[model samples]
Target: MHLLRIALASLANRRFTALLTVFAIALSVCLLLAVERVRHEARASFASTISGTDLIVGARAGSLNLLLYSVFRIGNATNNIRWTSYEQLAAHRQVKWAIPISLGDSHRGYRVLGTSQGYFEHYRYARSQPLRLREGRPFAADPFEVVLGAEVAEALHYRLGDDLVLAHGVASISLLKHDDKPFRVVGVLARTGTPVDRTLHISLAGMQALHVDWQGGMPARGAARVSAEQARAMDLQPEQITAVLLGLHSKIATFSLQREINEYRGEPLLAILPGVALQELWSLMGTAEQALFVVSLFVVLTGLIGMLTAILTSLNERRREMAILRSVGARPWHIAGLLVLEALALALAGALLGLALLYLGIAAAQGPVQAHYGLYLALTVPTLYEWTLLGAILAAALLMGGVPAWRAYRQSLADGLSIRL
Candidate 1:
């Protein structure tokens, strides 16, 4: 305990350099912990995006590609599934429910998803949490009515009864505007921290109405246009849809249904298990995660190296102090112990400060991150792996301190006596 006090007092005397060293390590530790936390939480958020769905059936393309466009809204679908196929599958005896998704439209960079009221009834996310409207009701009889996600409304500063125009493409600003077929915001959904939060929902009939004058992805020259009111009187059944989310009546039927869908004679379609696709996506991303982990580890190593440098450099200035201690009957091992304890102290302080920094960052950014990116960063206690990481950092610091400690220990009484300063 006396030696520990001596070590503390010595560090306190050089608080400036000690503080710098501690801060360096603390920042490194903070980055490492933050990366791990984000990686874990991101996977959890992605996996929970759409739950309780047995399959995501779409036009035959790469499974990852379909998952990306359908769930994450990262890319576009290669082709669309015919609406007839979606209807047939939805009416299947083994299928409990089906939610059709129509993409390829955008409102201020947010993807527009055209679906039925069954979306709110059957779609689930984050542990089977059902979608709920924060205000107003779902689209009713009006073909021009729209529902806004929490993020979309908040980002665009929209409210119930606000009129908005959707673009023909996914770009934030497009020349192909559907201004004539403006939609009134009827409902704003509660935030779910998923892709749903970044989406705008409208009835499937509403989607067909917007494109009544377009042919082959472009407005036909001199084509007679159907006004929003006239669109209601016309057939609005969609010829094609982007994808269909399926819920099975029985879990045992998943494989059989998947095979049946894959082998359908009418058109080529693919049925993917969300969980499997997610796992595969993560597996493909493992290399990038490893790269990030490696970079953070190097940052930590650099900080430890800085601490080692500071301690060793201070050794020259402390020679007289060491001589005085020797004259006062301090042994060589005592000097070594003091140096080792100082390194351990600095590392322990850094680890604690790093933890504090992490929580502070999370608290500061949690709201905005969820609001903008639809990522919910949970503020939970550190996992066992994190504790292990802290322990490893401390252990590495001790090993690094050995170099200065050995130099201090090897100083003989004669060497202390020879100190002229």
Candidate 2:
């Protein structure tokens, strides 16, 4: 306890340098923990993006590609499956429920998804949590009515009953607009921390009505144009769709059904187990995640090195102090132990300050991060892994402290009662 007091007093004497060192380490520690937290949350969010659905079926394409477009709303489909194909598969003996997905439309920057009411009844995420509306009910009966995702409504400041026009293509700044067939927002889905939060939902009939008058990728001019009322009066059943999500009556029949779908005589289709595809997708991204973690580790090492440099640089100025201790019958080991204590003090203080900073940052940025990125950064206690990382950091600091501790030990012994010039 006496040696600890002396070490702390010594640090207090050089409080400015000590504080700077502590702050540097704190920033590095905060960065490392922040990166780790985001990586963890993102992985959880990615895995929970879609659940309850057993298989994702799309026109024959790479499994990763199909998963990306179908579930993630990323990338365009290579080919669309015939509506008849979706109906046939949806009616299979083992199939419990199916949700057909129709893509290729957008409102502002958000992608528009045309799906059936079964989507609301059957789709789930984050441990089988059902989709709940924040304000109104899901679109029913009227084909021109739409449902907005939480992020879409919040970012665009849209409210229930607001009319919005969807663009003809998926581009953020699409030139072709479906202005003649404007849709009213009937509902806003609660945030799911998934890609669903960034999408706009509409009925398949609404999607077909938007492009009904278009011929050869161009909207009909003058005499051939179909008005919104005309579209409502005509048949609007979708001819083709982008993909389908299926739930099975029994998990045992999944493989058999997948094989059957892949070898269908009508069209080339690819059916992938959602869990398997998600794992495969994550494997492709693991390299980048590891690289990011390594970069943060190097940053932490740099901070520790700075602490060592500060302490070693101060050792020269404190040589007289060490000599005085030696003259007062202090052992060389005592001097070494004091230096180690100081290093440990700096590291512990930095780690605590970094933890406080991490929580503060999460509290402040939680809303914006969720709204913009659809990533919910829960402000929770650090996990065992995080504690382990901190323990490793402190251990590394103790090892680094040994270098200066040994140097001080040798100097104290050699200098004895004489002050070095």
Candidate 3:
């Protein structure tokens, strides 16, 4: 207990220097933990995007873009596939089911995904987890019912049986609307913290019905608006759609099915494996990710370097104190133990403080970050990598602490209680 008290008193003597060391380490821990969290979540979210789905088919363009737009709702489609192409692909023997997605619309800031009932049943995300409606139920065959994503419902404060007018384009003001036919909100999905949380889902028939009277993307330019009763009589056949999400008959047939899909000649279309396409996207951003990781490593190095500087600079002033301790029947090893204990305390305190900050950051940014980027930050216990990271930090602290201990040991041997200032 006496020796422990000695360690505390020594550290308290240089409170400013000790605090600086702890602050530097805390910042380094923050950087290191952030890098670890992002890397782990990126891979996890990417892989879990389309677990049960096997293939994504769309008009000829970059497969990566098609995957991003159709699965992530990230960008607008470059081109639309003919409706005939969707029917032809859906007829394949290897395909268990297929869901057509029509884009080019939004409600407020949320993307509008016009799909079929199959989408609600077959669509999966976050580890083969099927979509579960949180409130009310899925949209009906009725042309005016809408099923909103979790985020859309919570953000817009809509409940079942509410009314929503689809925007003409992806903007709030697109000079177009199905003003004559507003959709009734029938469902609200549970938050999955994925892109699905931001999408407003509606039946493809509803989308086609909404724009039946408009010709060539304009509102018929002052033509008579058709009533909802008249729209039911008209053919709501969609000529084109943005993409098709697919399910395979069997997991083993995925590669073979992908090969067949790419060679499909019904129209100029491309088939992509969502997982593979995600890797392509990540590879594009890999350089930036690598740079971030390198920067974090340097931050950790900076912290260790600061500890070394603080100790070496304080060694001269501490030399007399070391000699007094040696005269009081203290062994060189005892002085060394004191340095080690101080280093351990500083490292642990900084780590705890930094971890607390990380938790707070995650909580504060959880909603906005997920809404904008579709990336969820979890604040659970540290993973194995983080434990290893902490170990490395503690190891560095010990190494720097040894410098002061070694200096004091040699000084005490030569100047035993002699004040040779």
Candidate 2 achieves a global lDDT of 0.91
lDDT of model 3 at residue 255?
87
Model 2 off-target regions past 4 Å?
363-372, 378-381, 412-421
lDDT of 1 at 407: 98
**Model 2 agreement with the true structure over 5-98: per-residue lDDT tens digits:** 9989999999999999999999999999999999987887678789899999999989999999898899999999999999999899999999
- What's the TM for model 3? 0.83
Weakest 10 consecutive residues, lDDT, candidate 3? 411-420
True-vs-predicted CA distance for residue 325, candidate 3, Å: 3.9
- Kindly list the per-residue Cα lDDT of model 1 for residues 1-421, writing each as its tens digit: 8889999999999999999999999999999999999888778867778889999999999999999999988889999999889989999999999999989999889999999989999999877889999999999878899999998998899999999999999998899988779999999999888888899999999999999989888875554876788888999999999999999999999999999999998899999999899888989889998999999999999999999999999998888888888889889989999999999999999999999999999999999887565577789999999999999999999999998999999877676545555
On a 0 to 1 TM-score scale, where does candidate 2 land against the true structure? 0.90
lDDT of 3 at 317: 76
| lDDT on C-alpha atoms for all candidate structures | 0.91, 0.91, 0.83
Cα lDDT of candidate 3 equals 0.83
